[model samples]
Target: MYRKQLFLLSLLLMLLQTAAFAQNNKLRVEPSFWWTGMKDSNLQLMLHGNNISTMQPVFNYAGVEVKDVVKVNSPNYLFLNLNISGAKPGKFNIQLKQGNKTVHRYSYELKQRAAGSANRQGFTSSDVMYLITPDRFANGNPKNDSVKDMADKLNRNDRSGRHGGDIAGIIQNLDYIKDMGFTALWVNPVLENDQPKVSYHGYSTTDYYKVDPRFGSNEEYLELSKQAKQRDIKLVMDMVLNHIGSKHWWMDDLPTEDWLNFQDEYKTTNHRREAIQDPHASEYDYQLQTEGWFVESMPDLNQENELLATYLIQNTLWWIEYADLGGIRMDTYSYPDPEFMSEWTRRVMDEYPNFNIVGEEWSLNPAIVSYWQRGKKNYNGYVSYLPSLMDFPVQNAMVEALRDDEKSWDTGWLKLYNTLATDFLYPEPENLVVFPDNHDMDRIYTQLNQDADLTKQAIAYILTTRGIPQLYYGTEILMHNSEKGDHGIIRTDFPGGWSGDKVNAFTGKGLTKEQLDMQQYMKKLLNWRKDAKVIHTGKLTHYAPYKGVYVYFRHNGPEKVMVILNKNELPYELELEKFAPQLQGVKQTTDVISGKAYNLNQSKLALPIKAPLILELK
Candidate 1:
């Protein structure tokens, strides 16, 4: 009797311990939920838990079939592939079973997609994009400045530290943005950047699905999209596919051994972007460029891993569907595997045929940048599906043209004229994104040596040039950086972003005379471009630079406009006889900026010094 009682007590204790262990373990499903009506009828769920590979998933729903169960080297992960071709929008239960006992039950849901989600229009030449770094734009919610769970806290004194800016700040200023004549808003990354330091820039992403609590919730981002659309403004999302933050959840328990490039050890990239297109390059150099990590804190993603590639591709589609994004700006476009990038863009473009995605190649060579644009017939048989690329070549030439002296053919305005002549290399030159400066570069005012007139010329050229135009925040108010090559200072806080600030650019309070004048100048130019169809889709004709003057014309049918850029210290008379083809039937011209009128019948027209003259020819 004593032996029997001991055995029963021991068995009871064992059962209790097993029950407690089961209760403590929690299962996690990536893409916790999905939607129906996706163009692709396939779905892959990554299940993570303590030794989850030991069990099998079993589910029964009409039109939903489990096609494959993939188990990687890790015992904590299982990739369940399903073909949900005809699945209805509803909820179903998935059971993880050990023998006959069910250990975990997960309720999976299939949501209904928004109507006409796939056919949404993307930002184009008809729209002007306004770029803003959310952390320095404004502070709408001070409570989230220092999240208890996130390590980085608000430090207004520290230039690199996070401020209190949130999505709510942007939502509050939609009226101001709309009033400025900007039709599209491209904000820096707002996803979760849980790094211990320097999280203000938002380049590092720790979570793929969640927005940073410091910035706001994912719902707030959705609200931004909704509110922006109401104001007739499109929202462009900045995305990074090259790497992820070291603190990402996958780093703790990797689904596969090859999930990250150089998984066994840390190796920095050589950053030899040209190696990919170099015909005589060695395989060793190419591998290091594509597979090496960006930095110690950013783990380079291995898109070659089929499972990981599918996950990333699905993640991008999810955001486009969830947030209703107008376009995408892909960062570090040349760092990833070329084949994988080709497939990535193909998948996205297939789903949304009308969507546009611009990539950041950062190469000054038009040949290098043109290689990534769609419809390019490469000599090495490389195919790309990207719709557009940042026109870095033109940007560099424009800056040099404005600052260099016109003493030689290779110097001054000739550099800009030569760069524009290279447009034949691009598949669709009009689709490229042209800008005077961006967040990564020094402000245009600072780059132009604090000369407001040269800055105005740059803005005028970008707004009138072919392709889409993007203006950085505070550019309208002549924002400049005292220290060059410093990202923190370059992206300084706006005057009216925070409370108690003396100057508010939004309200034009406490601003210098020059600052207010530039603000009005930008307002007029932007609003004028909003309705200028000739500039949007016109045939560009140019007369080579003579002395210190450069001339170009934008003409569409009967509508015509002449642009003259002068780089002289003194006003001079510009001979109009050389532009007879374009000026043929012209009688009078009105300046778009000063609203001053000029007669075009004379052979000579007076041009201002160091200023841009946009004349509406009649």
Candidate 2:
């Protein structure tokens, strides 16, 4: 008995000693693993631990060479630049040694690249993206609502609090989204936002590589991509390269002094985006606009630091490869160093030539927004490789056009016509992502003052326009905010997402007649758009607004679509003579909305009052 007890004590001591050793050498490696076959032969691994910079890393693997070891000001971090040009799919141990003894051993893995990952296609004009805030969308697993380690807790009553919606919730609603005629899913950032409060928005990222535990694991995010792809729905990830949550792991022990802009101070941005392209802008204004923090809780990253830039670039690539993303919606695109952003997009596009990335410049001026597009000839010699940008000018104009009264030639639909006329500024205006409203703005329904007819007109205009269309989650149901410009209210929870809810938007339970009608109306319009090739790739020809009516045609060879927006309070007979160029041989047209036939042989066509009309020219 004594011998047995002694043996048990010895085994316990050995286990405790092993645990202690692991605890002492615990290392957090950004990009925990990598794939073997990437177009970019180089990979930068960021290692963070207790005094890890003091030790030397030793590893031996075929076709994998540690080209350089970069140590920053922090004693706990080490950046390893590896050349994996000829590396095969396998695993090897990277031993961190103190003198001759290996103090820590990290098992590094090189995964095989997914087939055709390099040439994966991105979201385009053909797709109608559904923008979802995961935390407000649904709650599939209640268990992960309030993770023990995360600072934020579940509180559905609080508009800005975490509401337990996660990856599982989105997974559960995939069918609904597919049936609704959306081909792309643009989910807000799922990265860890371990903030003490208001972390539900996901704009403040705490960890880049890991998905928030409240949302789900990184595997689940990959699963979302898989399931979305199966339904022919592309997944566009929302990324933030400008700033990070204040509680990020690196904040406690920054890798270097220049890791963050204004590292020792907190200064909010002036938000003067024009300074970037202004020829006479002062250095002070330009520096403040680019380097200042977004908010006190969000630290602006210093992309000028080569190591930090490489780290961010690698993180983006890692997510794209891991999640098999269809595209990326980079948040606050102008806030980052333009030079770094150019390089970032260049590297990403170099690896995946066909992929798309849309940046949010949030400027109402077309010239300002156009400068960031890929092929624009800027006066400042600033070149960009970015493929797409959010069409903020068009969005603003559309909203104003729908709401403004036709008191003068410059009011109402003329606003939209004039705005679109400036499309000549963009190198590829068709590639832009046009929307009625997004997560950061007032809900479209509310913006239109809850006028369902006006809302329909806005929706029809966005869908038929010459750019990729994106709609918020509840826009179809006319979801409106009681208060304007409140982000939390703008991104309210979907009615059917939560359990035991009185009204369920998903199941069409207890919805009002207007809501149901709008839902069905959007369904029919979207499905029709799904097969409308002319609307996808056609050349747009728009006529100036006449008598509170805006007319446009999308023509591709023999296929043609005529979209008419009538804001008249009474029925108006549209003179067909002006549109004869487009309706030359058309005798009759089909209403895409109501599926009714109208004879176009007459000199005039009667249009309903205050309604939008989409006619298929046959």
All models: lDDT? Answer: 0.92, 0.94
Clashes of each: 0, 0
* The candidate that achieves the highest lDDT relative to the unseen native structure: 2
Please name the candidate that would achieve the greatest TM-score relative to the true structure: 2
- Encode model 2's per-residue lDDT on 1-618: one tens digit a residue: 999999999999999999997776698777899998898889999988789899999999999988899888988989999999988999999988999998778899999999999999999999999999999999999999999977799999998899889999999999999999999999999999999999998999999988999999999999999999999999999999999999998898888898999999888899999999999999999999999998999999999999999989999999999999999999999999999999999999999999999999999999999999999999979999999999999999999999899998689999999999999999999999999999999999998899999999999999998999999999989999998988888889999898888989998999999999999999988888999999999999999999999999999988999999999998799999989989999998888998888999999999988988899997
For model 1, how does the per-residue alpha-carbon lDDT over 42-89 read when each residue is reduced to its tens digit? Answer: 999988888879998998988898999999988988899999998999
Stretches of model 1 off by over 4 angstroms after superposition = 1-24
Error of 2 at 564 (Å): 0.7
lDDT of model 1 at position 76: 88
TM-score for each model: 0.96, 0.97
Task: For candidate 1, give the lDDT of residue 178.
Answer: 91
How does residue 381 of candidate 2 score in lDDT?
A: 94
